[model samples]
Target: MVDGISFAIGRGEFCGILGPNGAGKTTTLKMLVGNAPPSAGKLWVMGFSIPAQARAMRRKIGIVPQSDNLDPDFSVVENLAVYGRYFGLSGREVRARIPELLKLAALEDKADARISQLSGGMKRRLSIVRALINRPELLILDEPTTGLDPQIRQNLWKLLRHLQKEGLTIILTTHYMDEAERLCQRIILMDHGRVLADQSPQALIRDSIESHVLEVHGSDLDHWVGEAPVPERIRCERIGESLFFYGERLDCLVASLDEWNGLNYAYRPANLEDVFLKLTGRELRDG
Candidate 1:
């Protein structure tokens, strides 16, 4: 249902498609990868017309899906070997790439281990290397770090960054605003099958939200908000028990923070999450 949305991603650029669930982020990715056909529109990937030459385009692109779908019955090496075969890669070529991919994924030591024997992080790393068995020019990741812990997530981030430096064009789809901020050079913010904005993460935050935010916690947030100066310019809102005040200048807020002593409050710069909420609205969307 994406409509009136048009843009281009340069070679070697890392771009993210970000939005809440049902926003068509995954649908857009599916269209680019040839899994779904556009009812009507001009679209191309890697110089090949989409859905028509979709198979041809698939040959040059690699995809890592939301879930780790590695073959549980196969060992690490076996999994990669089978995936490489799907790309028409010869056994010799696949074999040659196995060691290199293993090193790239930092899974050299677990090459022969069975899928069930590996940890979650190891399995995720293997899935990524499996996607790379064909040596793709463009890589598409759908929530690559969906369920991992912080340490493993950071480790995977390092790998993706390293790959980007090696000249791989990456298209990432994630709702995690921080993930987009850290990995993408540009972001396409989507909502209800529409492209709301397309720009760098920093640029979106700068243009959409105030420079700083004051997070007020504890009781009677409504009273605190009522006691504030002008309501419109301050841009105050309440979520659960906390209150947030957004504005370009926080001098007044900071000075009042000393007087707001009994109430737990913190002031910080606005970030990508703020920009996302600002553009998409704060209402929760059902999955």
Candidate 2:
């Protein structure tokens, strides 16, 4: 369902694809990997035409899917060895590569441990390195840190950064705006199967949203607005019990706050999340 979208990932670039649920993010990844073929448009990966040269392209890319698909029955070493065989790697070659891969994933000490015995972070790290067994030039991660705690997510981010520094091109898809901002050199924001904005995180925030946002919360907010009207230069909206103000500068709003008591307010610079909500609307999407 990816509507006629067109963009390219340059060599060695760390790019993020961001969107809400059912924004055709997963569908787009499937097409890129050749699991789903485009009915009309053509695709070329690493200069090889897709769905036709998919077999050849497969060798050049590594994928870490949304969920862990590691073999629970196989030990860490055995799992890596088995996956290497899929790429026609020699038993000796697999043996030689296993130790270094385990070290990179920080699983060298757990080499003999069963998949079920490893912690969630350990398993995720293993999944990332497992994709590298065949030494791919490009890596695609789909919600790589979803459902993990903040500390573990940060650790994974560090690992991904290291890989990119080593010159491997990376493409990531995630619902977390902050993750995309921190890890990706560029972001492609998509919604309803079409690209909405494609730019660096800083550029997107600068171009799409106001310079500042102010949130005022309290039962008195309704009464306060009646007493003192907001300036026409600032945009204002209300959701639930809070009033939000958006503008290049919120000094007038800040100054008015002292006139009212029992009101809680937060004023800060606009961020990628602000841009996302403004462009996509605040209504929730169930799927």
Candidate 3:
């Protein structure tokens, strides 16, 4: 259902596609990998027309889907060996590359470990290296760190950064704003089957939203706002129990918080999440 979506990722670029649930992010990815053909419009990857040259195109690309589908019956080494054969690799070739791939994933010690013995993070890393069995020029990751803990996610980020530095073109789709901001050189923001914005996280924050944000939440927030109204220059929105204030400066707003007892507040620079909410709205979106 993606409509009017047009963009190109250059060689060795680390780009992120971000959106809420059911925002056509999955649909766009399906078309990119040739799993679902686009009904209209020209599509090409590395000079190969999509769906028409999909087979050849696929040979040059590696994909790490959102969910881990690693075979539980096989050990880490066995799993890699089996997947390598899918790319027409011989046993000897697969065996030769296993050490390097295992090293790349930081799982050299777990080479013979069963899939059931691995942690969620270990499985995710294995999934990544599994896709790299062919040493693809382009890597596509769909929500790579969705369920991992913060430390594990950071480790995955380090691996992805290393891959990019090694000259691999990577396309990552994620819902975590901070992940996209930190890892992606450029970000494509999509919603409701269409593209809303495309820019670097810094550019999106600087150009599309206020410079600063003040988040105030606590009891009797209404009474405080009634007693001392937000300055006209500052934009304000009340969502549930919190009041969000956006503007170039929130010094006055922060100072005002002291007068209200039991009110908690935080003042900080605007970020990718702010831009996303401002564009997509603050309301909850259900899948």
| Candidate that would win on TM-score | 3
Superposition error at 103 for model 2 (Å): 1.2
- Residues 135-162 of candidate 2: C-alpha lDDT, one tens digit per residue: 9999999999999999999999999999
- Residues 73-130 of candidate 3 have per-residue lDDT tens digits of 9999999999999989999999999999999988999999999999999999999999
Indicate the residue-level lDDT of 283 in model 2.
84
Candidate 1 off by > 4 Å:
229-232
Q: Which pairs of residues clash in candidate 2, taking residues 3 or more apart in a chain or in different chains?
A: none
Candidate 3 least-lDDT 10 residues: 225-234
Kindly provide the TM-score of model 2 when superposed on the true structure, using C-alpha atoms: 0.96
TM-score of 3: 0.98
- Model 2: residues >4 Å from true position, as ranges? 259-261
The residue pairs that clash in candidate 1, if any, are none
lDDT of 1: 0.88
Error of 2 at 233 (Å): 2.5
